[model samples]
Target: MIELPTLYHLATPDAWDAEASDDYTVSTLGRSLAEEGFIHLSLARQVSGVAEAFYAGRDVILLALDPHRLSARVEFEQVPGVDDAFPHLYGPIPRAAILSATPVPFAQDGAHDFTGLLPEPL
Candidate 1:
């Protein structure tokens, strides 16, 4: 068997909770899988920046996803201005694929403080 890298998704507590079935359909904070066409995922090193950029001043849950458990296709696509390619899941995330759902802490300045929240070498 091949080992797949763990991917991350920053979601609101409400959004994550809404997915009560086997498949999670929410794409991002405000978008749905049907609307966005794909779920945005980040690498460990990109989690902090993504949280700061899109989810600043908000409390979020960090979902650790095991790609090997997912049935959807995970594609790494390069955005127009982004330096690194980002992983996008073409289908809804199955409940089994979520390894962990941890609450993210925030700093005094209303920014997400991802210290100690991510894996090592991040």
Candidate 2:
């Protein structure tokens, strides 16, 4: 399987404070997500469609998102069906967070090809 990004953590801007009981508008990004209604910041773009996927009824490997793109917080471990402090495992790492993303397969010139990598044992 292609090893684009091995791990990922959710991303959101800190526009809102916990003390405030209101939601911010993410429509500025593109479209409002159906479930959480937050903007998908639009930074996950990649060679594979799944890698650059939005959060509308879908799950994409984010690897790491940038602090500039962080408009709000995700309330912690918001990955559907995944409960607990899972997000904490990655901590507050920002977009530049280096990850084991897969190298681009098949160079545009078609002369080079990515050998790919082995999956890290979880």
Q: Say which candidate scores most in TM-score.
A: 1
Those runs of model 1 whose alpha carbons end farther than 4 Å from true positions after fitting are none
Q: Worst 10-residue stretch by lDDT in candidate 2?
A: 84-93
Clashing pairs in 1: none
lDDT of 2: 0.32
- Model 1: per-residue Cα lDDT at residue 39: 97
TM-score of each: 0.91, 0.23
Q: Model 1 over residues 1-122: C-alpha lDDT tens digits? A: 87768999999988888447658888888999999999999999889889878898888999999999889899999977889999999999999899888999878777887787788882
Residue pairs clashing in model 2 are 4-102, 8-63, 12-71, 12-72, 13-70, 13-71, 13-72, 65-95, 66-95
Per-residue accuracy of model 2 over 1-122 as CA lDDT, tens digit each: 32223333322233322233343332322333443344332223221322224333322223333333333453334545533222222123333332323333334554223233323334
**Candidate of highest lDDT:** 1
**Deviation (Å) of 9 in candidate 2:** 6.2
Show the lowest summed lDDT stretch of 10 residues, model 1: 13-22
